[model samples]
Target: MEFHEPVMVREVLSVLRPGPLSRVVDGTLGTAGHALEFARLIGSQGILVGLDRDPAMLAIGARRLNEAKGKDGPRLHLVARPYEEICEVLQDAGMTEGVDAILLDLGVNSLQLENPERGFAFSKEGPLDGRFNTEAQATTMADLVNNASERELADWLRDYADERLARPIARRIAARRALAPLRTTTELAELVREAYPPAQRFGRIHPATRTFQALRIAVNDEMGSVERGLKACMSALAPGGVLASISFHSIEDRITKRIFQGATDAKPDPSNPYSATTTEGLEFELPFRRPIACTAEEAESNPRARSAKLRAIRRMEVTS
Candidate 1:
């Protein structure tokens, strides 16, 4: 299977320049597409830590790195854990001081979406299991769809996917599951299509697109992970280190923007609520005022690149 080329490789490399002997982390390793590039840049003297919740992906990543790096390359520490637990990963790797650079490629990758068995795509026929870490005993998409109350379903649909027909969709799902459980991607997708107004059923995207996206997000707790993972990455950066994040949707971008802004923005004085002061210790600075977008050429070649947004920040040296 061909994993999609890592999005905005040029932009990501530009923002995160991992030099020889540098320590770097690819928080969302995927198939090691970005991690391979990082390995090449950091060289054999560097240390590369790759984290992924999926053992399958981590196995693939390790193989790819091993095959590509040969006998002489960065020391590899591929961990089967979530990026939100970076502090522990770093400490275990003996880098408690921090890494020189970190990369967080957020949202589902082509590997997961392409595999029908993983059930990440609305276009495919597969079980309603969308957990990123399939090995974990966490709630699956089927669990939520089959068991969640109508109100709960609607809330998740609206909050996670911005689905305009969330209530109707939830009602339809609740009604259908009462008779027989919605067990497959196509089953749920068709139901969502039926829930939409005839006119809206076929628009710029499939009627089931939002519902599937919302379900995957809810099943994986993606937004919460992104929030925690970004914060962990920021905290794990050594002085003068950089953290770059690539978000596929508005909500992920918003969370990244908020976290990065909070770190860089001036703080309100604790002693005087009315006064704002520059934070007195180590701080962060935005390398770019605006998020970076893929080139039109790249977007044409890789459709997924169209929605990709890259944001980066650097930790400043200690300042009293």
Candidate 2:
């Protein structure tokens, strides 16, 4: 199967200027698109470690990398682990602080959604499975919809998706599940669609888009993973090394913003109510205060690129 094109390719390459001898990490190597580019840039002398939680993605990434120049290509290290486990994987590979740069294109891969079996697309008729790693024992969207209390469901919808009609949607889900369990994507999507009025469905996008995004985020722990993975990337990179991340949603973007902003200096206090000394420690400066996005032309070519926001930071010092 052809993989979805990686978003913000130019920005990623610009942030991670991997030389022929540099070692780079593609922490969220979904389709190996970025990994392949890194391998090509680094040539045979450099090492490109590709990590992903999905076994299928890891297999595909390995095959893609292996097929390209093989013995003459950069040393390919493909790991089936979440990006949060970067430090452990790097240690296992004896890389230590040997990395030159790291990239994390966060959120679900388009390939997963396009494949009916993966169950990521609400438009597709498939199981409600949303786990990045099939081995993960976490509760799926099916379990959430079928088992959670209406109140709990409402809270999740409102908090995660910022949905105004969360209460009604939760009630509808509870009522529907009582008739029968929600086992598939289409079933859940239908219930959510029913929650909206007919006029709302005529809008620019599907009404169930936010709800599906929220469910997937909750099931996969996307925000938590991004925060933890950012820290791991910072720890794994060599001094002066760069770290770049592409977040597609507001929640992920907020986390990236806070982390990148804090890394620049001592974290600001929101609890003290009143505080002085805004200027602080470690010089983790954001190369771009505002995230860089794809051009309109690129977005036209790749619709997925429209939502991608690339944020990069330069590591100045190791925390003592």
Candidate 3:
């Protein structure tokens, strides 16, 4: 899909299990694709908080939300900042009791991937600026590729993207960047393609995909945000409230799973970053131990839904 098509909307709503006239938060409000649905679910008097780091996307989401809202639909409280600021936004909105539901769709939106200028897709040619919040003064892919040390690049690639060819790719990037800075996405993509062996270069996923993902995650501090954002979102949820998050990749899913179960996995692994296990925290209880996956039918229609792993938990009511 060219637009910001939300994956597993029905599944998300089902997992959230929002109550009527309750408050909800669409933490990654790309184009209000999901927020619009949440607005409907909450009724006119309910509150639907929308958040996005990208001003461009927040505007689009706001517009879509406004257009979809019924006369008595939930009020839209859209904010422009990383989802990590979830609690701050809610507190500022004077939400004393917290919210009843929260949905965090942690996928790279089509609004970004399809737009070459955002530099998220390897198939397209564009600048190497892959910051989700384009207006933020954050490090860009170009900055990381050009300035980060060879060892640092390799570690980052391996840690963030689980890229097997991280060492070789980092070496090549370091060498080439020394000659001339890699200013564009194509430049980095081409470098990665050359860095990969012929057998893997022609694989289903492009050679540069992992590197791009890694750089984007690094520039945006996505994993860190997820860590902090989850806690913030949970803290902002009322007792018995539900928090549903859709993780797009393995590492993120692992962290999300681990955190929800109330354990911390801080050690970094170079070979397999996602393999971290721990015990329970007891703040929230998983409705289902297994994460919900998109059905084959849904996966076929929406390619983005294929890798999505939906996990949800309800905050246990505080007892003395």
Residue-by-residue lDDT tens digits, candidate 2, 49-82: 9999999988988888898956768888889999
The candidate that wins on TM-score is 1
Tens-digit lDDT track for model 1 on 7-72? 999888989998899999999898998999999988889999999988888888899999999766
Sort every candidate by TM-score, greatest first.
1, 2, 3
Worst 10 residues of 1 by lDDT: 271-280
Candidate 1: which pairs clash? Answer: 44-73
Q: Residue 143 deviation, candidate 3, in Å?
A: 0.5
lDDT of 3 at 183: 88
Better of 1 and 3 by lDDT: 1
lDDT, model 1, position 199: 90
Q: Note the Cα lDDT for every prediction shown.
A: 0.87, 0.82, 0.83
Off by over 4 Å in 1: 199-204, 269-281
Model 3 local distance difference test score: 0.83
Best by lDDT: 1
Candidate 3 lDDT over residue span 96-214, tens digit each:
79888999999578888888888887787898998887767578889988998999899889998899989999999988977999988888898899998788778888888889888
